[model samples]
Target: MGLQTQLRRAIAVYRFVALGYPVLLGALAFDALQRPVAAAALVALLIGWTAAVSYRYTRNGYEPKVVYTDLAVTAAAVALSAWALAVSDRAWPISLGPWLAGIVLVWGAAWGRRSGAVAGGVIAVFGMVFRGGINENTVNEAALLVLTGFTMGHLVRLGVEAEERTRRATERDAAARERERLARDIHDSVLQVLALVQRRGNEIGGEAAELGRLAGRQEEALRALISSEAYRHPLDGRRDLRELIGRHAGESVTVAAPATPVRLPTATAQEVAAAVASAVDNVREHCPDGTRVWLLVEDDGEAVTVSVRDDGPGIAPGRLAAAAAEGRLGVAQSIEGRVRELGGTVQVVSGPGQGTEIEMRVPRPREGDADGDAHRGR
Candidate 1:
């Protein structure tokens, strides 16, 4: 059952003990007949306290002041019971112990160990002091009050912590399942179309041959991305950007980065890496097969900078604008769009013979920053 439910049941049990205490005390105190007025007043207070406790705490909500009130009333009642017994002619001690002890246990269960200890300590100390000296019964009652309050408080805290851990685990599991479902969808449709375009374009020959090769390269990149450990791992929104970027380095591609790790939120790092990969793919499709491409990663603890440069023939004037107008969006959607979503800037420099250099810069998000997704199509 839930922690609240358990506590309500415990409150009911304490209330039951409280209801019986006055009647039990009347029977035990043979001097009760001698001090009729004091006996009646004490009994009346105990009965009223029991009803108040039940009405305030048995259901859902209760104010913090109610607990303090209960403590004050309990302390007063214990003191008065001792006074009533001392004035009576009877030599017997009345067992008014249960009323205070029950309240201490309830406080402990409600507020945890420290609150419990305070409430329990007050009752135990006051009870012993009013009785004159510390005896075996006094020591046992004090020990019982301390132990019950602290133990119940600990149990309540443990239950709360366990529930929190379960909630986080459930969220992680659900996120992982959602990612797998999306990967399947992308593989079944987008990846297949890219692959088919590559194969058919190659068979058609001429200008279509170059277009097909570009599509083929993109298809391979997408396949590797979807199957990568970085993609398959749970989306925690934090990861090492250095690891993701390093995956693109092989053969004609060279990666230069610091020895230390470059960490970033998972979505931001992935989008940056995807943008760099798209730039490299452009180099392979347009430049010679053996052309060298250099990728540099730098992080100065404020922002991340990535530069992709290739020693290949650069684009002529107005080529990018012309391509955008014709609805070709590889550079727009794949690179610029991704970085823009991350609240960053991108610069592209190329001339007829100066080769191509694309630089992307994104600031490191502030700690506990409440931003949304850094890029779409994750």
Candidate 2:
């Protein structure tokens, strides 16, 4: 248990013992006033014993041994009260109050609700037997005491469960936020560097060219992994797709979009942008110098689509799928894999002689879909 919980338990034990002090003093004074020397001595001894038990409880930090000590003290108090009742002529109903209160304190600490109820039941039975009859006042008081202990114990348990749930929720939220932040950093920095290497490979002839091509392919695979739903950033804020694409468009690259906004899910938008960027990189590497690339963004009612077409040598039959299998999978893995994850389809209408037309279609997410909520919340 936590230090705070231990301290609270200690405080509860001390409070119960302290509450007995006034009752003990009152019992002794009543016995003495009635000229019952033996009864007064018994009450005095009970007070001293309770005080010693309380002291030991404080010293031991309210350990399990305190429960044994409490039982012993309660037994002595009950026996003394029974003896006093036998000797006293004046019906001393109030004399049983201290012993009953001690039972409440002991059972409340030891076994909680069930034992407290049992203790209360025992006290009620004793009251009826000793007094020789049950009265309205006795029943009402007994019911109130038992209910009070039960309510207190139930509330304590509820508070503990609520606190634990809150702690777990806070931890999960923190972890998600951290993952989102890391995703943003990777997308902005490392992905950009890899794209640059891929584009510059054509300019640097020979072995350096081959190295550049290899780096470019690796970059595409990395982008594919990042665009997957598993790596999507949760904190992706509202972004203008046209503006993001325009920012990356160079002199040779041409970006075309509708005059109106093409709002897309955060994950979809990021993947589309990444795919467009990769397509442009391929044109820069394979096509003749200064080849023009066109990017078109179309927003249909039910879905959003992006088309990246190039006036360059198109992909050969089975080449895209074969490249993906051989780990040379840039377009297939990054662009196609990303669209598929979003419950969308990627169509590559390309062949030798005819220019390549890469179209990506992502359907709108439904109300309660996990991916939809994830992008919307971001």
Candidate 3:
């Protein structure tokens, strides 16, 4: 059941339990009552109100008018207690007693902490005015009433906010996952067909070459549109690391990823992916023709690892440092820069004729934590 419904039911239950306290109080003071018949009538009225409130709550009576009437009746009953019983200066109201707190709870649950506190104060003030004076006992009772209203209402509000957050997060995850599925479908069908058309059109010259150029532009636009990370909450949604890496697979490149999605936040996934792309680009620029590349994605509970390997002439020992010293910073600025910004590490394993393998290791971002907080451990 929803939080509000459960709170209403709890109020109903409290009404039934609290009703007995006043009944016993009324019976004990019946002989001493100045107007015994009226006191008995008020007691019966309380019983009927409790039963009706319980039944209405069960039937989903969430109307504000019920709470209003309840507040009015409770206040009225407290006022009448002084007239019905001769013991007017007694510590508690003869007609209401603990039963009055139930109406305070209803106000708190239906409205919020402030409204509940107001309801409690209103009841206590009405009781004090009717009973002629506010003593230590009456003040204590007022404090208790206000405390009950504020605490219950505050707790209910907290639960409602928590539920809303959970619901929104669930919807966002679902949307991102569905979009990932659609992207794969488009890549497998529409993207491949467009690529084929562009290649064939270019092979046949003249007007066909111009058509091929147009086709290529359209294909790029469609691909970018489908893969755009322009979300309203851009950094919030999760994207599959697999989908980003899988797009690089071709005749000379092989991609391997977990059977299930290796999901990460949109920004983190995109950054990691851009880092991978940079590595592959570096390979293509320097390596010989027909050099093979492999991309591997691993999700090992605590962290995500993406590895790019190439069977090409390897970087000579200290060559990257020499290149960096000469201001040729392709590896440092693009690959290492992107990964380090995401609190990840990059290791380049290469020597002459050993080929090159670059590994990027990043701890999974902790849910509901800031980037700095993720570094602080979950």
Best-performing candidate as measured by TM-score: 1
TM, every model? 0.63, 0.44, 0.56
lDDT of 3 by residue, 196-287 (tens): 88998999988887667667755775586477663223446678888777777878899999999888888898888889888987887688
Model 2 C-alpha lDDT per residue in residues 1-378, reported as the tens digit of each score: 643255355545655565465355545556444445655666567667666766665456446666655655554555555555443444443344534555454454444555556556656555555554567756765785576556544554455546655665675478567777776787799888877887787687787777677677567656655565434443343345675566445566677887887655555667777776677677766776556778888777688788888877777899887887899867876788787888889889989978798898888655344222211211
List where candidate 1 sits over 4 angstroms from the true fold.
1-5, 18-22, 28-63, 83-111, 131-133, 204-218, 235-245, 250-378
Measured over all alpha carbons after superposition, the RMSD of each candidate to the real structure, in angstroms, is 7.4, 12.0, 12.1
Residue lDDT tens for model 1, 146-262: 887787677767776676557656876787788788889989998899888888998999988888888887777777777877877745657788788887778888999989988
Model 3: ten consecutive residues of lowest lDDT: 369-378
Q: How many backbone clashes does candidate 3 have?
A: 0
- Candidate order by lDDT, highest to lowest? 3, 1, 2
lDDT of each: 0.77, 0.62, 0.80
Candidate 2 stretches greater than 4 Å from native: 1-72, 84-89, 96-112, 123-138, 184-378
How many backbone clashes can be found in candidate 2?
0
Instruction: Write out the backbone clash pairs for model 3.
Output: none
Off by over 4 Å in 3: 27-36, 53-64, 85-95, 226-228, 231-378
CA shift of 172, model 2, Å: 2.9
